[model samples]
Target: MIIIQLNQRQQKIIEIVKENQPITSENIASMLNVTRATLRSDLAILTMTGILDARPKVGYFYTGVNQINLLGNDIKEKKVEDMMGMPVVVKKDVSLYDVIVEMFLSDVGSIFIIDDQENLCGVVSRKDLLKATIGGLDINKMPIGMIMTRTPNVVTVKREDSIVLAARKIIEHEIDSIPVVDMDDEHNVTKVIGRISKTNITKLFLEIAGE
Candidate 1:
């Protein structure tokens, strides 16, 4: 399910795509010496799972890179509010322990901390919490606000920005995630979103490649 380890045939399909060759079930079956029906099942399973994109005439191709670029060009036709995550927030007054627990339970490495007015006040990372606790600070008593990275320094993406831009930010910043902020305001994070994780990039590639 994680899509990290892939089978040999799946890896071969990806290699073909990487070569920019015409990819199809028939072609794949002939190349791999498999049945056309079997190849169809593989493609169907991949495309239906969001790992592959079936173009009108182009058949199957890698979705991670191409899909992201397509999303970039298509973004000009839509708004950021259409794709951003909903408002899921953590309060500044919450304890670091609680924040860590939330991070694990939510399966996110980074979390956004907001003020009472719902404004993005600070950003917290697992490292921040770990450092505080290892320094002999009481996680339960210390407010997350004391350890969070303050505003004007946190990396953020606007809701209206292209998803490609969001993915690029994650790579360029070497960060696990970013906050989706509203540009109309003073860059207040309306949603906490993530991109470029192994789940999105590698797994997607494997599945699309029919792994």
Candidate 2:
């Protein structure tokens, strides 16, 4: 393996390249108020370090480094269910205090609230609990179902949808997560099986970005 050691200047060059990737060395030099030759030398050092790839006519760009496991590049073909976390759920009758305890134990940002029929009823987030607590509402006395968002106008995706497509829903909706619902033979939502969160997309992106 060729290890390219970067000096302070070379590191700065890499940062510049990252900011204006596929940008010419001349443009970088102009931005940094340095000679093109100096920038070129820095770029060369970074390229040697495996942090960048220089094309003949194109320019310098950062390569995806520190890739995740073998699944990184394959996410486009992967489904959300494959990467989803185990279903962590709460019932409407459960006390808010119980839900809080579960949230802490699971170390998750939100909890899936289900109804008596085991269908998705609502969602409760850390913020929701905090808002209630701050307002002097008793956690132990409050039922999660009473405070939870009812039927939340949930956004969901089919189990067969690709991770890339699922990611777009997150970005476009500006939502933190989407419930993964199972459709019955008649094409109606039967129940929520999993959740896809921003954190999930971030992990996938970091994986594919190799860092």
Candidate 3:
């Protein structure tokens, strides 16, 4: 990949995000007295360089690139189980509308779906819900199971897995989160115990850098 040096505008963008974090692209452009179209490439470069964090429906925030290297060495061997957040689960038979309410209440991207056995069966993402709701389907009575990405297709990590591996899987899959699971060899299924998300990893980096 060709290296593109950070220009003065990019630097100013970083400073802007640092001060007024979670600022939208429109706002950032207005601050710089430019159109969002003019700022797009610059914003793209900054984010691609790990200098800024962009969240959909949210906005841009500085990821503290300077401190990222501080935790680079320490993060490789960290265990995901120690850092993963509590799993958010919903019964497969639960109404899609109910799941949507829970998703907003919990502020999570993906919600794990379980059967009567409470074993991990599927995963439903915010995108999935949005797409489902865009059309006038009876979501009030629609079951989440009908729309979920069934397991075996779901990417996951074990509690004992390294944080590096979890990070890799997340990047490779381009998913918002991965369920930390426990295997049931006898039953040949996985149980969702926790979830490791981009937010969790970001916090882990910040904590490590602080330490």
User: How would you encode candidate 1's per-residue C-alpha lDDT over 1-211 as one tens digit per residue?
Assistant: 2224445666676666556545766777787888987676666655654556667667667676442333223334333445454434699999989999898888777788888877788888777887888999988888899999978777787766765566677788777667777543555435454222324444544654779
**Per-residue lDDT of model 3, residues 85-111, tens digit only:** 999999999999999999999999999
**Model 1, residue 177: C-alpha shift (Å):** 0.5
Clashing pairs in 2: 65-210, 66-210, 67-210
Clashing pairs in 1: 80-159
| Candidate 2 Cα deviation (angstroms), residue 71 | 16
**Candidate numbers sorted by lDDT from highest down:** 3, 2, 1
Off by over 4 Å in 3: 1-73
The whole-model lDDT of each prediction reads: 0.67, 0.77, 0.90
> How well is each residue in 76-98 modelled by candidate 2, as lDDT tens digits?
68898777765578888899999
Report model 2's TM-score to 2 decimal places.
0.59
State model 1's lDDT.
0.67
- Best-to-worst ranking by TM-score: 3, 2, 1
Is candidate 1 or 3 superior in TM-score? 3
| Model 2 alpha-carbon drift over 4 Å, by segment | 1-75, 185-189
